[model samples]
Target: MKETTGFREKVVIITGASSGIGKAVSLQLASEGACVSLAARNAERLQEIAQECNQLGGSAIAIPTDIADQQQCRNLITKTVEKFGRIDMLVNNAGFTVVDKFEDLQTLELFQRVMNVNFNGAVQCTYFALPHLKNTHGRIVNISSLGGIVPFPGNASYAASKAAMTGFSDSLRLELQDDQVSVTMIYPGAVVTKFQEHRLDKDGQVRGSDGGSLYTEDMMTADECAEIIIEAAKQRKREVVMKPGKISRWIKLISPSLLDKIIIERVKKIIEREAQESK
Candidate 1:
């Protein structure tokens, strides 16, 4: 396992730092002595996390930001630079998803919203932070999802947005290769987090189902996911996949149809179980 001790005094800006994987990453990096900048729409939560970072013997500042807005994205980078003098790493982790099937919805607005937050937000932040990152020979860590690589049935918009993130990260990595900047894309499977509770439905309301049982027994914890990300950063790895075994990845690469069949069967089982329990 790669050690996070190398992060001492590093300046890392993490979007979506109010909770879930983002929050875990912030705390872990802070504990490793990184000066963390916590960004999220929730000011109170960000401040709370900032306090925790300080308590953990690392410096932190809270910057309330809605990454969906381009200006806010720019401001986040600007504030981080002003406070920390340079950006050693930029973690684009801000994103949300709607829980309904794409065909169950009529409007493109929700899809656009997902793209705005998941893809465009990262693009804008990267644009603003690139100069500072170039100066420091920094790193970019994008928190994409397994859904991006292997599409899910009820999460078309979310999957599409994450797929865009994966593509963007790949291209950006190649472009920055000669500049001493590294780009690492993370494809995480199901993780224990508050993400389900915060997701929206097709109508733009908070999802009605609790989604607790939707996770597999082997789901990773948010802290575990964070640790993987930190290790990737430390090693400047090109990519990381959080699947249980390498077979799944190989299946996708060699025969996507086979992968899709497996996913379909798994999803069918889940739906059947949910339907039976609803009775």
Candidate 2:
């Protein structure tokens, strides 16, 4: 028998499809002849990506959706099924973050806001798409982060939301095992995207485009990250953890104190930098 993951002409619904990993995934799958439903809060950007996907040889439709909204999540699934007839995959890639000292006296609304989009949003979409996915014996690929596995500083809410996803994906895989609906969890280290630029500040203000440039670099690109996710979904793998996250998980298991010390030092530098910026 030929080993075909049956990718061609497969129906895939990707959230956070406006940019970054989601956009990259949409284009790649489109090029491979998948019918992709692009969902995101940005209607204009979603349309642009959908157009690009269609031109790349895949059928594509843009459904402006906010996954955080349950009705919209339902609409995303409904619209995709209506257009494509069936769903082969659901990629939960939408994310939100807020950068601030955990002890800052700022309004703690950032936690709920981040959770709404990151965790709750993914949950909503997954729940709505599960029925469709079960019927097709499809796949659910979550775009988690390395921060979810190992402790990280500066973005508590984002990390917690991703951690929630890590746990959710694990349990969901077992629950859906009998249904033959595979769940693939991806823990990418750090992908170069508009993630930081869109992050909220301590006061819940947008950090703007310059936010990501100041923090870090030398990381994987969105296109590279998308490739890994696409392959993992195709294989229906249990989990795909990146190299750095794997090393950190090993270090944590071997010597938790050492990992704690490392995290503390990094947090110290982050605090010092924030102090300087605030002055």
Most lDDT-accurate candidate: 1
Model 1 per-residue lDDT tens digits across residues 1-279: 223338899999999999999999999999989999999999999999999999997899999999999899889998888999999999999888887888777798998999999999999989999999999888999999988878779899899999999889989988998888999999888888888778888888985456565666678999999999999988888889887435787998999899889989988998898787667
TM-score of each: 0.94, 0.93
Worst-scoring 10-residue span by lDDT in model 2: 1-10
lDDT of 1 at 154: 87
Residue pairs with backbone atoms closer than 3 Å in model 2 (clashes): none
- Cα-based lDDT for every prediction: 0.89, 0.88
Q: Give the Å shift of residue 27 in candidate 2.
A: 0.5
Q: What global local distance difference test value does model 1 have? A: 0.89
Residue 131, model 2, lDDT: 90
- Supply every candidate's count of residue pairs whose N, Cα or C atoms clash at under 3 angstroms: 0, 0
